[model samples]
Target: MADHVLDRPPEGAAADWTIAQDWSAYSAADHETWDILFARQQQQLPGRAAKAFLRGLEVLRLSKPGIPDFAELNDRLHAATGWQVVAVPGLVPDEVFFDHLAHRRFVAGNFIRRRDQLDYLQEPDVFHDVFGHVPMLADPVFADYMQAYGEGGLRSLGFGALDKLARLYWYTVEFGLVREEGGIRLFGSGIVSSHGESRFALDDPSPHRVAFDLERVMRTRYRIDDYQQVYFVIDSFEDLLRQTIETDFAPLYGRLAALPDLGPADLLPGDVLITRGTQTYASERAGG
Candidate 1:
């Protein structure tokens, strides 16, 4: 969902990258778009998405309709987990982004995509930011993981390993899966937010659903323009938090830097295969 990363601050701003949501500035059309996208995804996510993600929706009252006001949403979120959603012009610099997360502030873009762009948009907007990501912040474990990631991001800056660390975010925060009590379920915001990807990630069988491996994931490249060829699965939120927070990434980064990068579709012999993907979907798309 985070396709843009602003490297510099906007002109004539008091701060580096923060902006006002100006919630009232949104026209009727914007609110309607939220309603449409929200309703559409809700229908698709019921069976396919992680149960925690669904519960987050209700916990935050995301179902109340229209683009959420940051102030209002913050009231509930801050109460529940000390996490609050804030407004951003778009993507902020890496440090700014990490700082916000480190402080439990989630930045959301102020705009919404047009009706025609409903299916896809390269850059993240409010719906993509808030609707896609914020719900999971309702979960105590996920909230802690996000904060840990932010703190980790700051530390990672020193290791000269943001690229490797970013893949961890991509495979987990944006496009991860979980094995629930019944079956595998979608947890990544990127999947939960997309009507097409939600179904594609789970039921397609064309993409590999590999179990979470920190080193393998960091060494792997991911696709931004098409459906992910692989999705990493976690045992639970605790496992993910423990893996990232407890482990010192410095040595891991040094070792990974020397290793060759794995393509989005590549599966290592040692990979814990959840679904051995055929890559049919990616092939067909590439052909056309």
Candidate 2:
């Protein structure tokens, strides 16, 4: 989620961009905002969200009234998987982010979105960072995938493929879907965290649901301004971790450099189509 670079830490942040959660500073209104956002997503996600995420929510006991105290949240998180959540000013520099993940520390923003912005916000607020992302961190296999992604990100910098590598994170960590026993389930933080998208990603006919291909994903383009037109589905967390841990991306980077990138909605000849989207939703959005 740390997608941007900061010239330096803001006035109060540490060198690594870490800041105290300052949990006590949150107003009752802020707590109400978290509760409102939480209630809606909880209502939306059951059967729609990945089972691992649900299990993580139960394990972490994030059901309490207010925004979680990081100290308490970390105790449950660290106990489940060797991971802890730290507060950050906002998006940290990419390298700083990789370093944090490489060591199993997840950086989250300390603020919540205002009440009016419950549906959307330009910057990821605390709810999106913690409620949207942390639950999955409790899963052992997914936790390893995140660490592997960080280690891979550090390596990608030397190759000047951060943008391409970023597409991997955008597609998987932020907007990915996974095939479970019953059907495809939402695993991506972007989808699960969003009440609108949690349903649209699964029920709407406008977006393509395709199987995950590492290189194809790296070469694809994604939209940040709206709901995704496509989502890449993984076989399982174990398969994803296996692929990421075992692949050597240096050679893959070289090959990808010469290929054309795919648009968010482009359906290719080789794509494994799970749901061939009509793209009616995106088309209507553009028309309006």
Best by lDDT: 2
TM-score of each: 0.96, 0.98
Which ranges of candidate 1 are over 4 A from the true structure? 1-7
lDDT of candidate 1 over 195-273, digit per residue (tens): 8999999999799989898899999999988799999999999999999888988899899989999999998999999
Worst 10 residues of 2 by lDDT: 1-10
**Model 2 per-residue lDDT tens digits across residues 1-288:** 445656899999888899999999999999999999999898889888999999988999988889999999999999999999999998888888899999999989999999999889989899999988999999999999999999999988899999899999999999999999969999898888888999899999899999999999999999999999999999999999999999999999999999999999998999999999999999999999
Give me the displacement of residue 4 in model 1, in angstroms. Answer: 6.9
Candidate 2: count of backbone clashes, pairs at least 3 residues apart or interchain = 0
Model 1: per-residue Cα lDDT at residue 3: 41
Write out the backbone clash pairs for model 2: none
lDDT of each: 0.89, 0.92
Candidate RMSDs in Å, in order, are 1.6, 1.1
| Quality of model 1 by C-alpha lDDT | 0.89
